[model samples]
Target chain A: MKTNNGSSRAYSITSILILIILAILFLFPLYWILTGALKTPAAINSAVPQWWPQEFTLRNFEVLFSKRSAPLFEIGSLTGPIIPGAIRWLINTVFMAVLAMLLTCITASLAGYALAKKRFAGRVILFSLIVAAMALPKQVILIPLIKEMSALGLYDNLWAVILPTVGWPFGVFLMKQFAESIPGEMLEAARIDGAGELRTFITVVYPMIKPGVGALAIFTFISSWNDYFLQLIMLTSSSNLTISLGIATMQAENSTDYGLIMAGAALAAVPIIIVFLIFQKYFTKGITMGAVKG
Target chain B: MDKTLSPKLRRQENISGYLFLLPSLVFFLAFVVYPMVMCIWTSFTDANMNSNTADHFIFLDNYIELWKDPVFLKALVNTLIIVFVSVPIVCIFSLWVASVIHKMKEGPLSFFRIVFYLPVVTGSVAVTVVWKWMYNNYYGIFNYVLKSTGVIDKNINWLGDSKFALWCIIIILLTTSVGQPIVLYVSALSNVDHSLVEASQVDGATNTQVFWRICWPQIMPTTLYILVITTINSFQCFALIQLLTSGGPNYATETVMYYIYYTAFKLYRFGYGNAMGVILAIFIAILSAVQFRLAKEK
Candidate 1:
């Protein structure tokens, strides 16, 4: 028994040591990006790489901003002020992500509540369809969607990106997972009190499922912001590019500009990372909750 | 309550339910279902970007040609390799990490969780570009570290060489892939019934035995989920390939997802791309079903 305890203690220590090493491995790339972004060109391009930036400079970021310019946004004949293309791309990314999150939350909660509580004719079928749709490789639909969006005259619009993201049933599936946990007794009580559908949902269901919505909101925002393929295929014009697409295009133009690319990478990654950090709790819940009985 | 509801009450329920569903259904149907239907339909016809030539019904030709096409074959094999390799690695790696870290206190646990998950939240483009630079033939950190440590004698072209390119992409895929599974497994492990574990311990079961007997079965659903998602995500690893390799160095890293994008957008063979899409969907469905069945039997 003493030997067993001794071996087990050794085993745990070894495991923890290995875990820290692996954590550093996983973290090195982000550390590389941040430091690489600040490192001067000579430090960036040296034979022996700088583990940390020796010569810190904002020249990379300055060059990135100076690379191009675009009107901030367009509204029919009226256009917003001109800005650095990188900043415009960030703005576009925010618009796309926020709008997608908002629409997804609103639509998903309503549908998810109905699926959980309503004994409608097609509830089972619709719920199944939503789950099944969540499985389909989202990129597979990009081709047909391009044709469809073009037909609707929204091929280059941010709504083109936002609408499809909202259309994907992941948010609804996740929300339904949350909605199922709302006790039937609560819904029954609300109905018994002569609360109408909208009123009960607004007053009761919304409050109860707020955590789930919070999870979905952050999740949606991050995914939409980083949805590079959809943005690449759908948004062709430079002015319409999201930050991810913008960086991708920028890299294609100047492939070996490590410092410039890292600057763009920092621009693209940092804000979303900040968002993820703030909503870490809700986001974790969203991921794990959706996998329950999945 | 549902069974006892009167016809009038059921009717009201249906009305209210459908009304609630209407907004979501509109977006789902228009954006998802319609495109899906169009994709399947287009796969049967000879569609392209030529405005003068209307697409003709040419069923099975695209699917048949896909089997004969060498690049498609290579792509299919590469995608399967990615899915098969990365799925298990992700599952095992994450489950192991979760087991160790889930025992930690809140501060350390959250730190590990966030650290593992940062790659994913870093945005794929950011992740891809940085990886591209690090894998640069001349100035990459990998070569620098290896050479300094007497591992390799010279700088190796990580993405430019056919032999190393696929594995390079897979390594990046592993970093981004483990995040969600780790999150899921952590949640699953911590939520395992503690009383049962303590009882098993009192009966003198070892930690491994306790984990296998008490925790594993309870966490099987999460395992199945991780498997399916990792498979899907691995199968759809396009951004890294696009940004880093573009399936070059003689198509060594050509994946079906990237090929589909190439076929439809780059090559303008919409029908062929859609055909490949259909085949991919079928593979995912069958694999997911097989996983579900296996998990059930266990």
Candidate 2:
């Protein structure tokens, strides 16, 4: 708050300079992905790192797209028309992340509202369980999850990833935190106005907790999209790969093809980064609010 | 908190609460809770990919065997080293960055937050692949930059050498890890009781004194939350390992989480993997409890 003192001002300038440098260092990988994606094979393979690409081309994207092909999607006995496998993987990733986000928001909001406002038997126990489940190492659940998913025929399916993500309980925990700030009097007034439970939630609670949902939605999308561990285990086939998984698989095969891999990396990262940038305010609020009373 | 549960109210509340909770509970119980329970149960049995015979209960065997297995022991040690090394570094580093930037104008503040967060939003695959290239023996940026600057003579296989492999992974882990803690701490610093800060400043307290004495305690909960998450993340460090080293040249970077995947998937030792999973969960639970206890004391 105090900027008048010369020594303090100098200290602030030094810190800001350091911050700017660190910020650039943090941003370097992303800059690499975009530039590397566009760089020629020669530039990528050179002993000298290209701080910036000398020349850019879409050849990497061309190579990436031409690498493989798959059906866009599949039903029980039906499949969509053939397309670039990378596009299919992008479709799969989007589908998984979107479905997971929608389902988590819907379920977590309902459950979170209940945990926050309702007086019910075993509510404490249930709330406690949700918090504990949030902390449980996914490695624990994932081992049996593989078996359970295979048993339920969800293995190698997008639902295998989506269902577990929906069930993860972090969204519920976050939403409950947001919901707790809603005044009880407001809920009581809505009930007195003859609003049904669902109606009261839709009319009153939803508007207030939208920011929390925004936060959860953005994160759930990013996490599920980047959930390579789950995707690697649950999804095995080439055609069923998520974008990130597809890129990783591509790298494993063409290890030294840095341009192609960087293209794939760019494809995997750009849209989510855009989404994060758009909703970052809500995302920050959700993160801070969720940790406030913890 | 003020609401009282009369019998009539309790019944109505029960119905409505359970109704609201139904959809989430269905998925939670079926996927998360069931798998967790199954993980514990299977850990006590000799389950494998071979399904000719049913899994038989062999109580306490997997836990005992894990202690005797050197690889498992090594993985456990590696996991702990990552957690112990990365958690404090992340917390302190993030706190520093957050404190520095919290006072910045909105434009620059958002820019810093977004920058620090870019690696995370970029997803692990992209980040890992690029880092892999950077650490490559021949054309990697690290080797090129270092050799030119006279840091070392010959090219070092960053991810291949046991000496530098684990630390390299930890450095990448540190970058990804700081994003959230920084975000959390920035918000926490901004939200600190402003009056306390101003009062200390008026009393001629230095910036460092205010940060350490007033601001730090106020942000303790945020710090603790970040601590718990960073610990869990460091514990669950898998994708980077799976993509980068696959536990590498000499099992140098083998973490417990990676080992579990290797045991269950590649080797098909499902029971043993589940046991390791159970142990991992226990370790996390214990550490979180300890963190909460330590935080409570302050």
Fnat: each model in turn = 0.85, 0.90
lDDT string for model 1 (B64-162, tens) is 999999999999999999998899999999999999999999999999999999999998999998988888888998999899899999999988888
| DockQ, model 2, C-alpha based | 0.79
DockQ of each: 0.88, 0.79
Query: Could you estimate the TM-score for every candidate?
Result: 0.98, 0.97
Runs of candidate 2 with Cα error greater than 4 angstroms are: A1-4, B1-9
Q: Taking the tens digit of each residue's C-alpha lDDT, what string does model 2 give over B194-290?
A: 9999998899888889889999898898888999999999999998999999998789999999999999999999999999999999999999999
Backbone collisions counted per model: 0, 0
lDDT of each: 0.92, 0.91
Stretches > 4 Å off in candidate 1: none
lDDT of 2 by residue, A176-282 (tens): 99899899899989978999989999999999898899888888888888888889899989899999999999999999999999999999999999989899898
Give residue A151's error in model 2 in angstroms: 0.6
Judge candidate 2 against the unseen true structure and give its global Cα lDDT, from 0 to 1: 0.91
